[model samples]
Target chain A: MDTKAYIASGILELYVAGQLSEKENLEVAEYAETYPEIKKEISEIEAAVLALSEAAAPNKPLSFEAVKNRVELSEDTKLIPLNRGRNRWLPYVGWAASAALLAGLGYFYNQNNQLRSDIKLAETEIQALEEQIAGASDSLEKTTALLQTLRDKNVTVIPLGGQVAAPEAYAKAYWNETEKQLFIDAQGLPEPPDGMDYQVWSLTLNPLTPTSVGLLENFQTDENGVFALSNPNQSQAFGITLEPAGGSESPNLEQLYVLGTVSS
Target chain B: MQLEELVERFKQKDLRAFEQLYAMYARNICGAINTIVRDEVLAEEICQDVFVKVWEKSDAYNSSKGRFFTWVLNIARNAAIDELRSKSHKNQKLNLSADYFVGILERADDEPNGNVNTDRIIGFIKNLKQKCIELIDLIYFKGYSQKEVSESLDIPLGTVKTRNRNCISQLREHMKQN
Candidate 1:
């Protein structure tokens, strides 16, 4: 089974918290004995909990005598001393040594479990941090690419001022005439209403004609709010109009949100 | 001696073994009781009773069931909650606040209160998220089950374990920082 995934699932923490069911408790104990890493994790989680609960202890220490006096010891049991003969002493010695050996084994098992878990935690932490670094580097590369495109000499940056339909709205168009590609920075435009979309049009001002380019779909959810469309037409100006979900064959002049003339 | 050995000796009615285990967990058990009872002197009294009960019921504990700490923790909390419920008719009705151990931290340092480990406790929980604090209190202190925690916190059932793991992870980071 995926022991690492099981460890990461947080079940061990609940096990230490004693929140798991009877079956789950037995399963965890079994896992702890079988998997050193799980055992180590259970130990650390137990320790963290122990520390928090310990810290909540009242300022005054509870007298050991207080607890000692209240607890009744078994009167029948008595400790046998080693002052007697060798034969009598040998069994006691044997039991003591076996107990000692058992204790030693338990101690080493605990230590080994602890070390393995420490290494596992360190590895998981390092993995999380590496993922973060990779994510940051990925975003940095994309930003750098966007910066290069904006600085390209062949691209014309046309500032599209807000139109009367929505005076506060604005957008920018980066027209690469040679490549016939238009990049729109629609960051300044408000979100299109439900079931509506913003459509871009390439216009030839001489006859007041406009050809629909593309609709900015998924505008609200898009992180950058930038749309790129191919505009192969020999256009004199550009305008954006809001229309029903899909782009219209002809631009709706009244719904024009922004317009800008391209200077030749 | 290893914890298993100590616990073995404890189960065999060895006073020294009981003393060792008591010393290891007395404050923690008492603190846990205090979270429920909300009174230091009363909590101490209940804490002592809990230890005595631990001795009487030593044979019931098994490694397979749970950790020794967790076993005793259940005893301590149950005793405290019983004490609170029994006194429900008193003039000062006991309300087991959900805040748990944070009460000691928020109390003034000069007040006549159980302030011994408040500083360390504050350091341990410093900068922890509020949700983490509540989760720890509910599960660790109040002994809520996974389903109960999900319902009380209004989060998805599957989220409780993973979310709790992350919270405790943050808590461990706080401990390291201190």
Candidate 2:
């Protein structure tokens, strides 16, 4: 029999663990008896376990006298000192250890709490990241829709030039005639005052009439200086004007920031 | 004397042989018992009783049952489990980490629980892996079968034997070093 193969099988360790069946135990024992190398390996494994188990033995004076006194069968009565073993605990010392056990228990309890808090912190971080991802996806969807609208064949691009009120201001209007929708990119325009907003007007040059489109609501805080407004009338020009917060019923000619006419 | 020879003598009811066997195995047997009972005094008491029973049932112990120490370990574990069940109403909650015998050695540096030489034992097995600690605890101390350990730990059944062998090899290496 290959003793190395037998030792590597871990049967001897299981034998020492006493988890092997009786038949298996008999086979292992027979192998050990036959193979000196297998026998040595088995004993070494047993010794390591013996050392570990001995480490858990309580600290007490070992005297065979204590056990000898208890056993009276006496094939021959001879007292010998227990030379090596560390023996078991004394009663009082074992009892006193209850307090020490409590202290150990408290330490483990605190460790458990710390681990729980760590998990909670990790879960909170995951939730915050999830919220950020959701916000990003929402913005991505809105931008995609705006891109599709701007690229539509029915849409007309109208460039707006800076007016006398604010020569530096420039804006562009994207008009999708089929859908009666207008998108204004006012990236070059300055932010409106706290109590005021910029409104777009659909103007017909023949009558010199201006129809209120919609206010550029929340323009100061809007990172994307883009707005969508409805324009149903046949308009020759588009103008943006700064008005009081809600938006004015008509364009404030003095505050006209930009003026643009349809290229068509 | 060789362990086999001592066992042969012990079977013949030789008082010297019995004393030698008890002295050889008593500490390890008691320590193994304490891991279960978690009570040193009770474990010591059980250890004494187990030795007496081992003497009484000496003829029944055979090579087929395993090594002499394994037989004693079986008796000690059964007695400890019996007592634990009777006293289960007293709130003896055991956590996975702290209840293990290895836990004692690992925690022995600062907290003096279990045996006096535990810190020394920690020195011997300081570099031991967590998997090794768990395998040793379940197989040797808890008396779990390889299949039971595999299921409980959710490891492949074949891994149990090989892992335990490696762990024992590591332990032997540590012992040889220290």
Candidate 3:
């Protein structure tokens, strides 16, 4: 290719002025790259245009930083933060935080309820144990009193044999004549039927007269069937009979379960 | 060392390369804008805007397309022309015909600061034909292509290229002499 003829064509000048189309510009660019003379010619043309324009320029030139700052400011203004505005990523992060917080609160609430129930169960257990201790103490006091009565010098011990109503039922009574109190052990008796109770009576055997002393209401449920009854009458014997609900006005003779006598 | 290397670095978004490139052409760009806009302040402002645009659009530029200075010059010309066409400048003296590089020389000569030796410019211009002046003005300063110059100057289409070559050769000789 005649590089000089191409240079003389004034295309390089138009190329520098950006008047050439893309293909022509690329051709010129290739030519300029390949040939140093072509390159120098293009540069000289650019320099002439530059000098012309510079002479036409105002006396003072602008600072490059000022222009760069404007560029930077424009970029800063245009850049939206990832979290700002209606970003696609923002909703996902927000939902994730909300879900995590909800789960945490739910877990804490469940734990709180479980702890509360545990405390309630513990309180109930403590109440039940307290009741058991009180009952045991009361039973111990009753047994000690009964032992003192049996060891008393003026007390007479009598054995009661089972009668026709329950032939296997037996009982024992300790009479403290000075104190007018009788302590009966009816542990050998069977449980009375529902709505029925066992009543003990002080009796005079010669006249066959009976006086009601006390009724054992909770016969089956009582762990120890030791009962303390007042026997103020001059009793020669004691009788136990099964009576109807709320205890009978007089003992049903047919229901007599045991009988015992105390000698003077 | 070469202008190609600087332009290549500029394309790669090298700030230092861009600064060097700006220093090389900023005065020319301001001169070109001042020629058209005729207001130094407005020309400087537009010149800065043009350079910034060149930096931003550097990627769009390819040596295959044109010279980097040509690209920057095109930007300055378009910006100045756009400013002239804007609504605000509509009422201001509409001397669209006088919007040329020669107009700058004329305006400068009229100014107090234009004491700088314009004899070189005047002597160079004195030898050129009036048609050459209009052709150079349209094709170079106003960024008109050959066909537009032909149509605007009512000349033969083939004459625009040859005539422009001669005119530029004369200008280059004058520049060398100065």
CAPRI accuracy category, model 2? acceptable
Query: Which residue segments of model 2 deviate by more than 4 Å?
Result: A73-264, B89-98, B106-108, B111-118
CA lDDT, candidate 1, residue A39: 89
> Alpha-carbon error at A66 in model 1, in Å?
1.4
Query: Global CA lDDT of candidate 3, please?
Result: 0.81
| Predicted candidate 1 versus true structure: per-residue lDDT over A100-133, tens digit per residue | 9999999999999999999999999999999989
| Superior by TM-score: candidate 2 or candidate 3 | 3
* Location of the lowest summed lDDT over 10 successive residues in candidate 1 chain A: A74-83
TM-score for each model: 0.54, 0.53, 0.62
Show model 3 residue runs off by greater than 4 Å.
Answer: A1-5, A33-40, A67-200, A211-227, A230-264, B8-17, B56-61, B79-98, B114-119, B122-130, B176-178
Residue pairs that clash (backbone atoms under 3 angstroms), model 1: none
Which residue pairs show collisions in model 2? none
The residue-by-residue lDDT of candidate 2 on B62-96, one tens digit each, is 89999999998998888777777777634755433
Candidate 2, residues A132-213: lDDT per residue as tens digits? 9998988888888889889999999999999899999899999988899999999989888789899999998887999998
Residues B69-91 of candidate 1 have per-residue lDDT tens digits of 99999999899878877885355
Off by over 4 Å in 1: A73-264, B89-97, B108-118
Please give the lDDT score at residue A232 for candidate 3. Answer: 89
Clashes of each: 0, 0, 2
Ordered from best to worst DockQ, the candidate numbers read 3, 2, 1
Better of 1 and 3 by lDDT: 1
